[model samples]
Target: MRGVRVLFCYLILAGSVSAQNIESLLMAGDRSAYNEIMSALQRKDFIEAIIGLNSFIPGYSSYGDLYFIRGVARMQLNDVEGARKDFILAKASGYKEENINFFISKEYLVGRLLKDLKMEIKLDSLREYRPVIESRDTIQGALRPERTCFDVYFYNLTVKILPESKSIQGSNTIFFRTTADTRIIQIDLFPRYTITSLKRDGKDLIYTRNYGGIFIDFGEIIPAGKMEEITIEYSGIPIVAPKPPWNGGFVWEQEKKRYNVGVACEHLGASSWWPNKDHLSDKPDSMIINLQVPYGYQGISNGNLRSQTDVGSGYNNFEWFVSYPINNYNVTIYMGDFVNFSEEFTNNSGKYRIDYYVLPKNLKKAREYYTQTKDVIGIFEKAFGEYPFRTDGVGLVEAPFEGMEHQGAIAIGGEYGKSNNRRDYWTKDYDYLVIHELAHEWWGNAVAIGDMADAWINEGFGTYSEFLFAEEKFGYPEYIRVAASNFSSILNIWPIVGERNINSNTFLGGDIYNKGAAMLNNLRCIINNDSLFKRIIKDFYLKNIYRIVTTDDFIRHVRDYTNTDYTGFFNKFLYETDPPVLSCSYSIDRKNNLTFNYRWTRVGPDFSMPFCIAVNNKEYIRLNGTSFPQTFSYENVNSFFLPNEYRYEKELVPPNSFTYYWTTWPF
Candidate 1:
């Protein structure tokens, strides 16, 4: 029955295999154009790559790899949205996951936007590169009893996007109950936006602004437990997302000369688009979004849409409501010419609609690619419990940027039409964007981070979810492949989990995503128990669902669940960039038996994790930092050689040849 359904969906959207063959077709449509672009890219001639790719794209726009190369070129050129768009198309086209991710990392790396992720790219020494365009001061809003005094119950936002003038006018109604007594309420909005009005209970209120904060006088010390609401009206031309998801802001793009609008305010704070208490720790229990755009375009936001109405002359209104708690940054609005397809996904959790919205021209591709949503969600639900936002269902928006784990409404820009559609290195027949963003419904969104500093708490778990997805689909070998691909992006210049009370604008390159995932993979290996690891993940989600949490909170959960002390493991990996190197040296005893000695260098004071040492491919011994003298008897083994089959992750692993093994990972 499932196969029958898949086949029917495939025919209507994906087309027959012969109809979409990727054979070498000359006459303007071929891999040579893309290869030429990649050749220039290989030589680091980003300019040449961009020019050739942009010129060649119109001819072979359906070729998936072309967009991947061009995205890399655009990142090098500092055209962030362009890079993101191309990467999305490449992902849709079925390009290799790591290939697409490698280029995406380049955008944040070269842009030098996020401080924690900046170090992954070593080319920062290059003089002619994109500088960090957006700088935010989030410490003041991060933690203060005054700002955190009230718990947000609901939010109502109405915004008018003027693309031609590049401006926005909006109002946000914040409904909250005071957790503590306070007279002044603190909310945030970028200074660029002008405050037109502030009101509570139909009475105007005075407010002062500083460092993106608006301090409003409630006029009275509202007692604790009292529920209150405030509405702020503001208008202005906001800062553009210099590089979205990193130096986030509004993204005003053009698709075939029409307006394609979206906002990625993750690092810049939601204040860039709408007024809010812009802190990760506080999330509104629910939200109502009404985005007004010029006619002929539909607006999309998180959660389900309640209405689409045309209010007289040349304008349309899209009102959406989110039924569960959401971070301010996850509150988004995308306006464009979109057509959608919907399918009901049924699993142990229940039956719900999985919708995909894309450009009218890409509807066929979206249809073909979206069928995988059911499979991906099925895997996730089995591992992480039933979908968190069943009321909201699951949605995929063809965003103008690469992608974001936007609560229930995930933005998938990889147009999959001309991309690599093969599971060549992939464990399952799934799209990386689809699987990744949905995984966030369990990790990044349902269970969120309290501070941007603890971003690894969201991203690391999200990255590991992808690893688990592969493992669930294709077993441990696939897990190794996925883990290895994730590790390739780990430059490890900074810690995965960040310090509190600071803005999350560091550029540790791919540390939070890739390195964090690697650490989790290593942790699973340390536990040497997949079932227990699975329980830890599922239980952690149930415990923190819809609540903002920290890395310490997660570490404690892991420790409590496993009944073991992993303080040093989490500390060494999450708080520091470098992993401990275990040096191996062996000696031949008088009886011709080999005695192996292992010692860790540059390790944390008490860092220890168990790893397996296989001697002569026969004796497998589990050893920690303190364990040594793992002897291999002569009768059992004459010489040593490294075992190649799946084992716990150790980045420094090498073949047992003395010179090769010793020369590989240095101290």
Candidate 2:
């Protein structure tokens, strides 16, 4: 009877592995098992999952894959020591399948778990070059009849091209979920391309090809909400040609003395060559990047550079992968003749190296200029928790424009001489642009947003961080003055509503970056508890690590942790487009009192707010009104000249046509 029981167990395990649904078995390993483990976690069956994993992991190498899985599981179980041990083992064991994501994430997650800021942990901080050929292909499985949610996965790809337009495409599968009756996959395809054809589940499917993307009608609604996998094959000129964002062939203009190039496909540029969901709300699990570039040019993408082989006919294939979940916009590529170097840094967090890939000519100047990068990195790690992506060092890609905050790699448009050219850092402090972009490794890259609406969460916070760095490295007064300057700009550009004209992308420059930063600074002042505020910021990052968040989501998080309601706070600024301007005056009275009479005219119709009024810089009182007249008095004879300072913030409910005017007793 015992032998029969053992035989039955063996059969069940075999069937599970064959079906590729060994989630139950993998669970025994740890939280790191696989995506299958995520569900078991939701149900709170952690211990059982661990047992199954321990018994089912193939070959169960205690050092590499097996140990990595164990560490992930241990983390979920709150076993920090065990998780750390497993992660270290996995890192040493060469767990490179997920772009070494397991190794890097472990370093990031453990920081919050231990709250040990002084601990020095390091990962490669490198600059990336331009992507030669990029691809993001999605496969939607046939949905089950009753399924309300369906999983969609796209392979992140980096491709290379042969001399005759022949291409080699490499991609990794990314998993996600959708609830729309039929998924509207929006791919960012800039500059346009040609679609050869497409297939669904091994069968040719009719597709509609346009500049935006090639959409295929799956024919019929989803049945049983089951799964269906769709594959597409197409090719085109590199979206970001040698000239950049829009140039077609390959020819550098000698007169320009530089390449007129840019890869500004943040958010929606991926579809310029491939098909995708195009938005931030739906992020992919893991992806593979494959590229085929002209024999002489090197192609680079999101993950660690894996292999480069000559494919003949003037074509070379390069492949990369991102093992961890990455935002759609964070996906990138770099290509050109470049020199690569790696250096090491040892600190409390661990010993890691920084890498830099720059134009060969700028080697000496690059070294001298970027020396402080390591120290600034150390400071950010202590503050923001951990670096977001894999790969070390920074990639200084040559661009025709300015710098961009690419994960792990930042593309620099200028040479080393520009470092001391008076335009280096915006405030003449430390390298503000460098520090600002690096901070995004934590805020924008690690703790991402659900949509562009919360772009302020990324840019605003990043800009604020720049100021904070200025304050710390420069001085507090500089910081205060910076904040005031931003506030003043916001006041000038006060829109009656948050509605920005898409045609005019410039609106975001002031409102999103400057105004948003000022509002955050003001909130910090009001909160007053630096210790508590700092913890809240840290907690926010830790809680949402590795996932994309939204503005409402951010507000809710502040609401939950701060034990305070920020609904009013956000409603007043972010929700309302128009800000109120105060106008009022007062007269002296015989009863040792000053009679104040004031009428307010808002910037818009729906204007309503509460503000502070100061007289002679001595007496401060609160005034309230909304597009109407109100009068109040101060009990105490004031100075011969009553200097009234009107201090107020905008409310969120104002309409597009709103404006304000103020009149007082003295007038």
Candidate 3:
């Protein structure tokens, strides 16, 4: 509240309100009234301030600063609607957009106030204002009893894309094995679609629709260990994506005259357009996708393209088959007037095919630009074992939006340019979109997460792969420089892991990508053995290929591999929002000898991490920091430099070799 009052005073004195206007309105007597209102606001007496402003506003109706102050008071009183109106009025009355927008944007307002005002507001307390989870989200995100009774093994989907009308008609034949005897089961599809028929062995079945859940009754108790199949016939217009990949839906666009169609549904449930068990826990062992599109356009999906056959007048069916277990959301389709090209990647493991699908206009550029894929793949293979889907072959499709890691058919966008030009360290030109999505082929597609809460495993590893790529392609100096740039983006407002069993959008933030990668890098510094760290990552990927895993599974694996327990490390970085703080104090004796005391703060009792420091700005030393204080003395030292503070000076120490905020007392 004091900061709010100071901002108001600055705005008034800095010409947001002209002296002529204030002088005319105040008339040398009413100035004290305005001062009283601001004093009330400074005291956190919002009600008194609002009352004073109510009387003062009618006299000086054109004063935008007055409206701005009233808006702040209204917001403090939880009158958001009234505050919004006052903010708009302030802008219309000539208040600077930059100043008013600080109160208008919710995310910026909360973050700024939390910092400048030093408010005693916990981020957890803000959860009460978050969007409430509805019944539909529960049915789609949770593994209820109805969904847990059956395990899906395969999916045979046939769909026809009518891009002219922006609609689709499809049928999915689900093959599942019953784990428990039950007379009913649940399948999910958006309620907007019409279910023409639900059948088992060509006989109609009884079912009821509730939101996205379609509960079907079989009329008889299916015995345990029984395999059954059901084909659901449905058709509808899928939701159009306002902003793709982030807003999960279908993208229907036109490249000149030809239609470009694709769908991405990572956060948005797959049930938005298809019928299946939408939860993440159940991934089909294999899949067959048949997409029928206009004869001139090519239809693409995950895995290998088996065949393209003319089905009828003006249409052709492109059949695809996936041989390994796949996440439901990773299943996708792309349709456009595309030109195809291929190359063979021969490595020590074996030979594999890499396919590129691009618009006919960019075929020549794509051929030259996409050659880097081979080198990237080779780097990943050397670091984390061979590619996971050797049999299916790798595919990259040009997408309308940024990018998405759709199993084998990765989406590539960003206009095929270097994505991180904001940092001067990027001396090489490379497509970050391609590298990031390709990395997902190993981290997200092959080694998947069972619940969205553990999305850090998918995105964190994918982002870290970029660091690995930098080390191999550009050298270690470039890698450390880029890692420093990546670490600067961490918000640390929320924990990397979120609550399970609900469809949470926490992974949409940069923390999951930046902070998660930083956490892994810190772990490497703690292990202090580069070869062993690489071995641990490679073994983890090899062991869990084509499998669903959780954060706990990774913790257990690391514990067994290194013979050292890092449970407290993971708990501090993943489950908590604040990073550990390193507290230090130093004193120089009369003889110029330096004595330093350092320890960790704002961490658990069991937390301890080793970080490097430069003594006397010359020699390097590594010290283990714990909750308890430890001291180190150096003779005739001039200065001590902590690596965490001077990260850009890479020659002195490596950047992000450890993770912590640092504070030091005067000598």
Candidate 4:
């Protein structure tokens, strides 16, 4: 958690050169903002620490680990209820009690674990670093399967916005069915938002609170396969998003003489604003969202906009309906000065409009930047499938934070074409945000993963889509150059897959984006056939459309479809922190026949991957190896030129390493 507040502060301070290394920040000067809170925590000044933390967390609230640090500060101040609330927020933010146990226990104070956490803090400055290292705490937060035999179906929600007071009033009708005899149900809403009334079939129901979970008693058993509904009304100032998407909550901000607002819960969990099942596995097939906001402003939601009608007293109700299934975390609402314009694209599947919603002032910039959306949609449609929510259409809304892939309606902070940081590798003019966020329509929206642990399924593919777009728009060479540039951001500190049921971005560090994409790009080389690789990519997305899958589910598909054994291949890459390595040597036999020997090292014992090498900078050959050494023959072969993917020590050359992978041999 200390990594979070301090991380963002240093990110602004450190430029491209320092982006890859977190420890470099320590060598820089004037880190008072980060130290301010640390000193407050060390002095047991909870109020001062809270005040300092307030400034550090905006725009990154989904970062739950930081909230845990605040929880510790709360505990020291004897604010038991506050600490309890922060702990629940932490769990939702992905810092489940189990994951933090070995190094930092849930019950332990900041002072106790400061020694081990220092390195964790220093490394997490870049989104690329997080701890996938497992703890020995036999307890595993909520990774286990659900005990309740009930499944959520739909959420009919009513939200009344009161941004002036920084609070909201809401009612949610939860439609669910029981799979087994049961009298109890669990739903979550942040504790700060008090439950005003609870009813089932118009009858008041008795319920009890357990942190963020609100357990209701049905009084009589609801038989297996029974369908019922519960309507709960709650009102309070929801946790104001200190930061969004990352440290998410309800966001309230002022722009253009009125409040510009949006909700970004992502890892923070939807319960931060509205009440629901609050888990990834149970996405509702459809939803009805009704929003009432001040008359001068408008509210936007997921899926299709159904209606906007006057509701008296300078307020209007906007009803939105989503017929397709949606992740609860993707549920959102943005209200403010927004104007809409749309362009239609006719694809083989159907015709859908590409929609844009931005502030009046940003309309010029948005128009100029968003012209790339149509081409981007084409690239993904060619690669994966069609747009995910065509009827709802593709959406872009101006938000206070940078941006988020919010299902159909994406959020664009202020950076239209600018903040899309591709570094010097991308030789194009398109903004990174639009391309990256729209790609989610395929990876995250259309084909979804159940557990946050497999989030690479979303972030990784979404990221690689940029390279593919470059290849499609520019050429294959440009794609390679940009894709190669991706390696500079890679931090192999943690595995891409996190613990089951946890948000992969939470504690696993941030490689889910860069590392995940790099692995996929490298996999293209390993498959050794561009046609087959493209087919695999397209097939994986098409088959898993509107589905929830895991890393194993994907790897198995790749292996079974290709008629190759990738069980160990994927296990090492997905579960291990280090990437596969190759150790090599060459000798010229007396007969003038050159023999090359290579072994796969720093990988699973059964690891085997393909490699391409050019001899005398002339002919190229593909080589494969497991843990054992393998040899290749080419007569009169001189020096070798390896592709950028290889990692080997130079037994006979200076520099001892290629200009490729940052990590050296003995990896």
Candidate 5:
């Protein structure tokens, strides 16, 4: 019974099975049989469950749920062949393919029977559950002719946020230069908003709405290279975030009888709350944000605050100016009863200001915890060059949600780790939220991605920055521990890079953050040169600062810098769901020599990655492995005993300690 419980726990830990699903299956069948089988399972009695299942299944041969339970019981009892047969029978008896595939993909059956099943069963299950991509997705995601006809250079946005009604009234004056001679142009705003007026140079402009896209007709063809401006006046209730930073929208909440409000629209698009192009490819060169909130509440936004003025009504207008090219999503708003504090960050370049905004109650604790911001900024400057927006200065706004890299003004949440029960990853104490969102100041805000598909560039680098911070503050072992923890969360179900031009949220999964970081770490291992790796990262950031980038761009930069083509490496790691598997075997020769053979599996035919292996857990030797088997011989080693059969066929090479891959041995 203890062994059975251990096996069940192992399966849960491996992420191969869900206990809830097992419970659901147990409760689904005939009432009397369910009672018997569930009681046995509750007691961790696999033998008793198997005895009951055998009798019940024979009586109800078509019961697929019973067969699945019997398979699970057999698996726990270490009857691999019996479990395999039961699983196949269960599938043939019309059990859910997803459940069957998940069970069969476990480590126990992976090396033995997985090859016999149609691999598409798993893929088909995924396809069955994929959300239908609508026309709105295509319009928002694709670069249509209307969107490409003009290039936005600036945006002057003024909004009056009404917390009482949970609505906003605003106008965005768009300044653009024509790229092509066309009278029609497209901008995006959620259809929920009512457009009171659309004008260009004081003349009314006609527009039509479809999905979230607004197509405007200028009534005359603006010549190529012409400069133009348009102002859109609109008002509506914005979507409230179901889950912030992940699902983007306005967050309206109250703390201590005061409004604690802000907005985050990353994947959901800035258009969720305001009118804009609503695509990653377009970034305004400079902008002004004028936000009007209720009296006594401070309104904060990206970049530097230009002024705060009482508007004579019940609102105060706080205006901000962003002096550099900015992603639309990075433009945000925070309004609350806030007090301010400032610090100066001095580096090789010069002294830059760092501002903090918090509720008046949490001011003292914020000051103490936020001192680490300077250290984080300095460390990142050394790694990724001078802070990209030093001219704008740095600002941290206490937010209602976890955190977000909202350009110069980052959103930070949590109680500064004082009362929060989350564990610390580094030897020295620091806020993961602060460190992660700050890292995005360099990765996501400074060096931006042109498409959501390459969002790993933003999140992966941000996560890896935690590794860098750990290594710089503590040591390599501590960094390894952090990296291993990140690797453990990787799902590997979807590729880090998703289908392009579809507004896909595939990168929203943990893979983009965890697996993406592990991939970068693995690349460093493959390069085997810390200085060169750091140089590559710094160079990439320096070259692409304030510019949108793609995964191919970084791959090209790595190739150019390293003097080696890493296309296959990126293809395997970024484009594929699973890492390469290094299948290994060995034989003892009569001359007391051991001959080892190795090859790559579960990868492209051209996939070749270098990895290190330690013989007898001693000194490490690096070897380059490809699809074709390679051999190496070591002399004067005694013959070792071999198990009669390989139990669990594969073990994941600890990603923290080595390159990302898997290893399998047959004896």
Candidate 6:
């Protein structure tokens, strides 16, 4: 019955595809594109890669994959403008998830804008006219066939973390495509860490060092083509500790004490600690994290609390297993004096628990802040499908910055600390950030996007969830105010894709979080009916659980459920540079026909937008970009100005357009 329902919905919009056909298409598409791009990259013919990517973008605009690959190629060839254009196109295309959009936007903003010193200086200094012309010539390249397969399988990873001197050592891992053969395997590890030993599937093996890391020739490639696992063992202190990207090793702050921080391989930082395949193509079934920390400090990792054994002589061994599939980077650890609070709750799904773990000193404060977690959980479960993970529950770990939806264990730290009395604190609330991170369990952790390219599925939706929580708690007006504040933050805009820092993207500058939320609200407006929209939300969560969806996937869901043809939706908002500017005017004429002219001022480039215009106690519909200055006649009306009231949200600001329509009320 469920399958029938899903098929019916699929047929309504995109038309149903046979499972076998979809598999064949998906595999063909992925393999062909991957082979072409990889070959181009290998030959260092980034120009050809860009051309191939350009040819690919039109067909897969819904998926940011083509644009992202284009951006990578442009970056490789030092074509900043070309890269920026592709990334902006990708961002505008609107992938199913926010991560991809945000990632593309970040890449354009940082990678392109900051490509050189002069442009970087101008952008940093907020120059009046920034250059945005593509300097690279268009190159012709071969087009690859598209694949539509959606196979579920696993890859094997064997990592060995060794210690160098007392402070640091080298570590590496071998990644095998399948469980069979196990001979031709790829290895990526830190060179600083001395390779004391090497192994392949428990047997000793030899490896060759590569530029970035080490590569192990897995005699020949194996094809398990199913969930597979590989184990590796070695000993060495982490070589020259990783700082920015990878968050592992030791960082000792004099006042803060000796703390063991773990940010493992996030974004592209996995190679800093261990050698492994850091790509997003294949995800492991489950992971076993074992840390042998020096006797004193405790090791905290993701997943259920397994066990900690004191190995005696001031050494302890911590073994944790995340039965759930997680990304290479999501695996993290924090070793410090920690206090824990645990509670259980029963929901329609099943029995689950919520745990708040914090430093002993902040336990009291942590409880006070997280007191409403149970309520928050209840609210989300009703909206998004069931929480993805069960065993580990929700654990809040301390961090230096804001919060991270670190799968089962969320990292919460100083980002939520209160300043002066909690009543008069800045932002007046810290729980909002906590709520944002917690909601990610469903949006990001559970129903994760295939790649970071669709980050909006995680951050934008997660950020929007903050506003949703605000609406539920404070009411509509408060939600509007919060949304407005968030929108106000995106004063300037730039493309972001494949940018270096996920942290910077998460805590983005301007008003990305808020403005991004506003964008979703705008989307809600387009798909007005709450019942239908809410149903779409519910259905999206239910169907997309544990699956990586691209922007096209989301659009398919929305269009199918609502029976709306919104093919132009992404072209207007996600892909373009303009926001709609509204000009309002209304007046009762001699014939008692109230005249209203709502002119649209193109903001960035131009965007077709739909908005409601209220005039003289009645709301009138106005499609801003659909036509130039749309005129409306009301049968009876006294007087109305550009805007009947000051209640109009000034979110979509115009670039250089003005309003000159005369109205009786204004004159």
How do all models score by TM-score? 0.75, 0.61, 0.80, 0.75, 0.80, 0.65
Error of 5 at 46 (Å): 22
Which of the predicted structures, 2 or 3, would earn the higher lDDT when compared with the native? 3
Query: Between which residue pairs do clashes occur in model 5?
Result: none
Q: Give the clash total for candidate 5.
A: 0
lDDT, candidates in the order shown: 0.68, 0.49, 0.76, 0.68, 0.76, 0.50
User: Which is superior by TM-score, 3 or 6?
Assistant: 3
Order the candidates by lDDT, highest first.
3, 5, 1, 4, 6, 2
CA deviation > 4 Å runs, candidate 6: 1-187, 190-195, 201-214, 221-265, 420-430, 495-512, 581-595, 599-608, 614-625, 633-667
Deviation in angstroms for 378 in model 3?
Answer: 0.5
Winner by lDDT between candidate 6 and candidate 2:
6
The C-alpha local distance difference test score for the whole of candidate 5 amounts to: 0.76
Write one digit per residue (lDDT tens) for candidate 5, span 1-667.
Answer: 0000011222342233233244444435566775777777664455567778777776668766667777766555434446657888888888774646644554333222222321111222344233356688887888888988899999999989999899999999999999999989999999999999899989999999999999999889998899999999999999988766666689998966789998987777899988998888889999999999999889999888899999978999999999999999899999998899999999876888999998888999898889789888888898889988888989999888768889888988766667664236664457777888889888988899877888888889998998898888776756766776675455455688977776766543357887788899988877778899999999999999999999999999999988988778888899886777677777767886878898988776777777654443333456778889999787765532111011111122322235556555441
The parts of candidate 1 lying over 4 Å away from their true place are 1-136, 139-141, 417-428, 587-593, 604-606, 612-667
Q: Candidate 6: worst 10 consecutive residues by lDDT?
A: 1-10
Q: Model 1, 162-252: lDDT tens per residue?
A: 8899899989999999999899878889888889999998999978887788888777788999989999999999887765655567788
CA RMSD, predictions in order: 13.3, 28.7, 10.5, 14.2, 9.0, 18.8
| Model 3 bad stretches (over 4 Å) | 1-131, 418-429, 587-593, 614-621, 635-641, 654-656, 660-667
Residue 79 lDDT (model 5): 44
